[model samples]
Target chain A: MDYGDSPEEGAFRDRLRRWLTEDRSWSSASSTDDEYWTRQASWHTALFEAGFFALAWPKKWGGQELHHTFEVIVDEELARAGAPPKPSLGYLIQGISRFGSEELCDRFIPGLISGRDRWRQGFSEPDAGSDLASLQTTAVLDGDEYVIEGHKIWTSYSDVAEWCLLLARTDPDVPKHRGLSVFAIPMNQSGIEQRPLRMINGVSNEFGQVTFDGARVTAENLIGEPGQGWALAMTIVAFERQPAELGYVARYAKTVSELEGDVRSDPDSTRREIAEHIAWAHVQSEMLRLHVCRRLSERLDDPDGGVHGSIDKLLMTWTEQSVGQAARHAAGSATSQAGGDSRLGTYLYSRSQSVMGGTSQIQKNIIATRVLGLPSN
Target chain B: MDTRLSSEQQALVDVARRLTERLGPDGVVSLDDDDRVARLDQATTEAGWRRLRDDDGDGRPLASGVEAGIVASALGQALGDTALFGPLLAADLLRRVGIDAPGAFTVALVPELSSLAVADAGRLPAAVAVDALGATSALALLPDDGGFALAAVPIAGTERSFDLTRWVSSIPAGTELEEIAGSRTLTGDDILEVEAFALSLASADLVGIMRGALELTVDYAKSRQQFETPIGAFQAVQHLLAEAKTLLEGSISVSQHASWAVDALDAGEAREAAAVAKAYCARAAIEVCEVAVQVHGGYGNTWECMAHVYLRRALLSVSLFGDDGVQLAFLAARRMGV
Candidate 1:
């Protein structure tokens, strides 16, 4: 029942704080979005060299083979330091380490761990968003290669990623679930084109409407069996939806304190309104954080207790959206005013929290059917 | 950082759950019956459940806050016909305030439960609305000898309360009041300790009530059918129940932590943790009960369905110490250092 960090964890956290304080590059890492990947890559490399990256992975794969607590500690420290998130790093490293072939692992794992390369998740499409198995992307078998042709919407950081973990249908005649295959496609190939979609926040999140027309992936790039793409995608997305996605609740705590400060600093007229908003944000954030921490603790105890991920997804969306709304409420009329701050834009961006990583409605359905064991209609 | 309950704690919870099952609705004919309430209370006291906070022969607390919390949460989950809270809380408060009492009774004068207005000070007693049921007396603060003193005053009359399971007692004027041993001027830390226990136990109760209501609704949804399919087959019904389940689960997580904080954290931290738990659980419990009724459709609204019972208890608990608004304001004010 003790929730405080262990003595070891406290020491690791202090060390991390000292390291971040000494590293001058981290101060500008988040502000330099123009070179997001380059800045984030170097930061990730620094974290790796300092033995903080891939904490849960085996030591042979450039990881420290530490417990999940180290990962949780790192997540909290990164949020506290305000470092830019290496969004796809977890998916890329865990995906390859777990399911990729030996040669595939030797080729891509080191590069990813060292932060020399980045990967983009290419699972969602315009027609097949939540029903991801119905993705129309095709990767037909060619001579020693799979020629890929498809359009991927909302592929985050696609323009910056050197590689893409793309899910494409190889045998359309078969059932949608069994006909799919995943490929590690080189994003720099001749037929790959990425058009950045400016987010509602007026920031290029590096999200792109990527078109892969006859983009060829070598035979060695295939991950797992051809029919196993659906399962593989599920695995990767599960990691994306876990409490790891909440960044160990530290990020939300930071947002809440910032909002609380805003509420207190405001004048009397707006104080009550903003106070209520902050209260809701603060309580809901704590609720979600506690729930996620318990879930992670459970997972640490029992890895097969994996089906409750939809709960985390739902809570994450609710908390993020609540925090965004509270931030906007704190600003009041200034939210609509030009040249104030990006809080309003961030609120707009929060709308995607429910949309991406599966919609809120979809998460509800999963909870109802899979977790609750309710009859599915 | 371990969140799992220890084996002893697990055993305590199991025993508590067994007690609830034996005395809950399935075991008792009517929880509102005074005879039933008294009988349940006696049985629990005989089982040594009433003196959990009392000192053992070695002068150590018989049970820790964490252990008390487990038992309280289990009793809360069952929310049976027993009058456990009053005696348990009274015992805990007596230990903190350094008082010794013989029987099962509740307390007043806490910010969440009741407050006192000092009038002419003497041995004379005054009437106050104390939120407790099935207790011999209530410990309230009275203006005595130019300062506040804790007294165990006899209950003159019992009145109906919003929480059907518990009764609000009316203290008559000029009743005999026995002051507790070592009772004197209260300190700020004393109030905070009482609040920490009250709020944590109440939050745990709300979590249990929510879980109980949600489980009942899910069972009903599975068996009840419309249009040649179980109502649970429909996404509309399923989503409602799913949301209720999520709320229950989340409340449990927070409430458990709050309970732990009460046992282990310092007074200031424990107070804040209790407030957070109470605020969230109060809102969540009310929501879970309301949605559980909605999922049940018509039958849920009937008195026989047991949904209203949950709603009644949840509503009563939510407002007892201060509802979500009171707690949030307290929390926000603390955060602002106001």
Candidate 2:
């Protein structure tokens, strides 16, 4: 019933805030791609070394063995301090911890946690974007190894990552969902080619296309039993959608405040439109915060509560585009004027919000069929 | 923070549900008639429904915004009429300012009525509307320099409403209408809190209406058949009902948070949350009821069906304090720091 942090949580937040404020390693920007990734990996390693990497994971798995709320607090504090984002190794850690064998967890969990092995997602393909179960990626068993061959599109951080959690068809005769399996494969293997995919916002190489041509994965790399990739993928997707607790609410609040400040000072003709956008942004941000808290509480009561991550995704995307649009509108002629404000870039970037996690249309369908108990066609 | 209701709140909701069920779905059909209105008022008073918002010696209301919202929702689910909102609203306002309101009272913040019996004070200079149904007295709210100057005014005359269940009237201007002496006023933060409370309560009623309409339509769809199979089996009908359900759930989430904010958060936060709820629910109620009618087919358009009644109530409730656009503009003004 209470939204304020508990006394212990408050002290934990203060300690994290103090540490973040004292950290001097985040100052200078890297001049090159190689330098950028190197710094990112080092920063991630520093986070792990500082015992700030895993808040909700078990103690045996190199996590702090704290409550999930701590993770949310970490997220809030990090965002409030404008710290660098945590590396995308949660899926690797979760998949291995939850479903991977003991041998696999012992061999890979530490490496991933310590930032010695960075990971990327390899699920979506050209033909398997939303209909992910229909992926044509194949992984055939060859004695002790499974040889993987297929193309993975929209694979983020592939260039920077050393490995991937790959989904491939192991048994195509059964249903599309039942025929798949998950594998952790090294990205540096021979015949594994990665090409940069330019995004709509004109950000190049952030997303990539990786073609796995006879990329060999050992039998030990399989996350779960054969024909369990769909379920495993679903698990990973759920993890991916959970709010990155660090400062998501804070970030949105900051955006709204800045937007309000701009709109207050701007003498734009479209004042009402800008104001409406800012207002909606404020509402969505608050809703997002409440939803995260509610979901956290729900998870405590029922670990398998009905999935509302789609709704969260919908709201997040809507707020991003909304606030971004408002900022751009308020920036006025500066957008087209020489040395235009970066609001245009933000507006364009937010366009991918709905497209990234899951499309808005797909979220609506989930809301319609799954949440509403409606008959799905 | 927990969003689930506590056990006591759950019990109160169950009690409200039972009371609402006794009123029946046909209760609203008789609302326009004076005799039925009298009976409705008497029944509600006997049940002590109007006193829910009143405090219990500690200066704390017997039912917080959450409890009041839950009861309002129950009334809405039973297809109860708008006649209930005035009294519940008036009681809530009176309780906050330490004024003793009767079992049935209306609060005025808009002016005058139109021919179809709909209240139309859009063009009026004053911010006042009259609903004198089943009330011994009415509270008039006059905007006074960022706050409210309140006055207890006696019911003078009645105006027939398009919404028959709600007895509408017009308050006199200048020297004619007498403002009761020692009337309570809410200034500064208290005014904003009351405004937010009003929005939350009204939207809670809307959420109830939406839940009721969607449930009714779904039930009808399950049994009512066309071309041999039941209509619920059809994708068109199911999707229509499903969308309504989504809207209904969304409205409920926002409105529930609004109620919680009013009770738990600071005044400014409460106002913003309430504005969000009002903006969403004001339109969602109309859309949900409209779709309910669509799903009901020919029966939906008939006066005998509860669908039209829901639609009428939703339409009237939209402009009670402010409509969707108005609420949005209010939110926009706040965000713009104006």
Candidate 3:
């Protein structure tokens, strides 16, 4: 049950912690929305160059091929040191590593991981909430090129990304799960237009729609097998709760730092609840490490279908929501308003975590039908 | 830096689990009945657990190679006691770490199970020793010459404590101070050591108890149905069960964390880690038991119901070994460096 990091892993985590804490970009600097995003990309690029990004991918794909511990060490250290997260950077590295081809990897993986380019998700259409499979965005295959024309809403950092991991229908004849194809949509392409959709979660900085009208692109931008986008998606998001997601590293440290914050002025209920929630979150992290350690020790490379993994996901998503709720509650009514440091934004972002990666409802369905072997609806 | 458990230590946990199963589970259910209370009745003194720990060399711990088993055995035997495992494990660890107690006599007030004196004075026979009401019968303040005697008192109202497989006795203020070879008083260094031990034990017990409650409720939800299909098939009930599983799983995490923390005492972060773990376990255990009962329907509320056993036992644990309030103070204070 000992889930402690190895000496080397510990050393790496300390190094990351020291770097993140010492770096003014993540620590002392308070930048405008534009400055923050651009600077974050630069910082991420630095990390990518350091071989600390996309650690689990094969070396051939510009990854270090290190153990999951390497990733955990980085995430945990960054989180504990109060380093601002590089969401776009994380997404780009992992996306390219998993779904990009040899050509794509050759062109993007090294630079993307080494923090050269920013990435955004072009998954959600305005009408697609939980019904993502019903995305109306269409991509017509042409001679050695694809004509893409559609609108994707809630596509985070659409305007800022150098590339977009867009999911489109190339074969609508197949079922929703099989008809889709994922492409490394170039955000800088001529026909593509990004419009920021400001929300309560976004800081008036764009988490908007990507309109691809007559967007022309070479077939090379396609990621994974065409028509297997959903499966590829499941494969990627399946790693959401895995150690690769920084469940090993960042999430735990985030809780600890939050616990370390100045929350004493809040109500007793708020303070106690925050403390309890942090502890619970810490527990969730420990469980993740235990499950991961046991699996790694036994060399058990089970897929996400295993009961243990589901249990980990269930615990994580639930606690994520709970902690988010606690943060909101602890802040009182003002937390939801436009003012005050974006507790509301974080709360909103966290609410969608369960829904975005996998909703609690969907997760339970998986646990009952697949993990517990109970019949489904 | 090595937070990884060695294979041998991992095996030690397995054996501990096995032994706990053998010792009559120290779970909520064990704390649930007349049988538990009756078993702890002073009538069983000669054959009871106090004899096992306080026994002469005739006991198993003194035997070579059996010491590891003793750690597991103490955990198993004190399943209901909740407070003994810490001190017992600490004593074992002290030997393992080769750190001598430096004295032949000192008393450990299982904090949760026993009370203590604010000031140390001479010995004299005092009136009566409180039994910590029986959560721990390790030792109590008593009076002698100028100090106090150690007398054992039976815990009141706690006969109903879940997992009543063990016994508790108060040692009056001034009971004759027997200088055992390794009797280390609850002193400065020993306090942290024992605190860690106690928290770890309670956390582990919560994990086992929580696992049991979840199983029971899941079974009941499946067997007892309302809308044609088993209620467990319903999303709402499934959600309820999911919460229990989440709580149980969380309990396992923190509980195991505390145990592992104890194993790595020099980490500097160990005590704070243990406190956090224990505090979370207290809340999770309570929630698990309460929800487990809710899931169990009417059967869970019965006087003889096992669910109540776990519930009551979990409640008792909340206040012991540094209650949630105590821990919150310790943790928040420590984090603030106050």
Taken over the whole model, the C-alpha lDDT of each candidate is: 0.73, 0.69, 0.55
What tens digits encode model 1's per-residue C-alpha lDDT throughout B236-317?
9888877887777778878888888876788888888888888889988998999888988898877777788888878867
* Per-residue lDDT of A18 in model 1: 89
Point to the candidate with the largest lDDT.
Answer: 1
Clash pairs detected, candidate 1: none
- Tell how far residue B35 is off in model 2, in angstroms: 8.0
Candidate 1 residues A1-377, lDDT tens each?
56778888788889888887788576333321445544666767777888777776666668776666566667567666666543346655655567888878888877777777777889999899888887899998889999988899988765678988899999989989999888888898799889988776666755789988988999788998788888888877776776554363655566677667665665355566567667777888788767766775676677534777777777777778887787787667775567546556546766888888888788889888888788999
Cα deviation at A366, candidate 2, in Å, is 3.3
Instruction: List residue ranges in candidate 3 displaced over 4 A.
Output: A1-7, A10-35, A86-104, A242-338, A341-354, B1-137, B140-186
| Kept native contacts, fraction for each prediction | 0.58, 0.29, 0.25
TM-score of each model, paired residue for residue = 0.92, 0.85, 0.77
lDDT of 2 by residue, A106-193 (tens): 8778777778887888999999888889999999999999998899998877587888989999998998999999898988879799
Q: How does model 3 fare in lDDT? A: 0.55
Residue B197 C-alpha lDDT in model 1: 75
TM-score, B chain alone, candidates in order: 0.88, 0.86, 0.65
lDDT of candidate 2 over B54-149, digit per residue (tens):
767666676678877887788777755435666766766666666664544676665422111112221212323444656655666544445445
State interface RMSD in Å for all models: 1.8, 3.1, 4.7
